[model samples]
Target: MKTIGQPPFYSSFFLATVIIALFLGISSFVTYQQTPWKAPASADAKKNPLASDAATIAAGKEVYVKECQSCHGKKGKGDGPSAATLDIPAGNFSTAATQGQSDGALFWKIEEGRKPMPSFKKKLTENQAWQTVVFIRTLK
Candidate 1:
């Protein structure tokens, strides 16, 4: 039994836990927001060799449906069933945040994913990845 003015022993522990949780949450949000997912300058320079013709777009759409629709949504709006489960928001392909990126940057990102987005480098060939970029362009 402590004095009325003083908090109990467990109170200190509870306060510490709350403070740590808040710190971690804030840090995580700030970290995710602060960093831009831009690829290397060299990657930006790389060009998409495949034409954006109907056949290429069609192939890309097929791949997107099979691979990305689970997380990126059927319309590429980042509202897929799995999107809710991720700590980070699945990219909305229609948004400028994604559409503004060059084809090469997008392709590199697909090749080298961040914490939540898995790298398709092993799963998809270079051509497929490039085609994915092309398909993403038509997302709007």
Candidate 2:
């Protein structure tokens, strides 16, 4: 027979497990929400070889359409279909915060993506990544 005052052993264990899981889940969410996705100072210093060139910008548009449009939207508004499903919101490139960043900083971000954003360091050639930064600059 079980005692009236005390909970069963399995029930207590299950409650404890649930509490711990909840704590971890909340902690992770808070941490992820608080962290900023900033490139290193070294990365910020790295310049784009093809900065603002018309042809490079055009090439970058093609790459953005093929690779980034799904997550960043057709106009870089961060309102893509998949944006609804992400834990972190997709960046709005048209915003001043994004536009204000240096080309190198933007390039570094594209090369080394954060969670929910795939890194293009391996997937895209250096030229292509730099070109993408050029295309992003045109988003208004």
Listed per model in order, the count of residue pairs whose N, CA or C atoms clash below 3 Å is: 0, 0
Model 1, CA-based lDDT: 0.89
Q: For residues 1-140, what per-residue lDDT tens digits would candidate 1 score against the true structure?
A: 45888888899999999999999999988977757677998988899999999999999999999998989998899898889998778878999898888888999999999878899999999999988889999988
Worst 10 residues of 2 by lDDT: 31-40
Off-target runs (Cα >4 Å) in candidate 2 are 1-22, 31-34
Please name the candidate that would achieve the greatest TM-score relative to the true structure.
2
Write candidate 2's Cα lDDT for 47-137 as tens digits.
8898588888899999999999888998999988788888888989999889988888999989888888999999999999989989999
The best candidate in terms of lDDT: 1
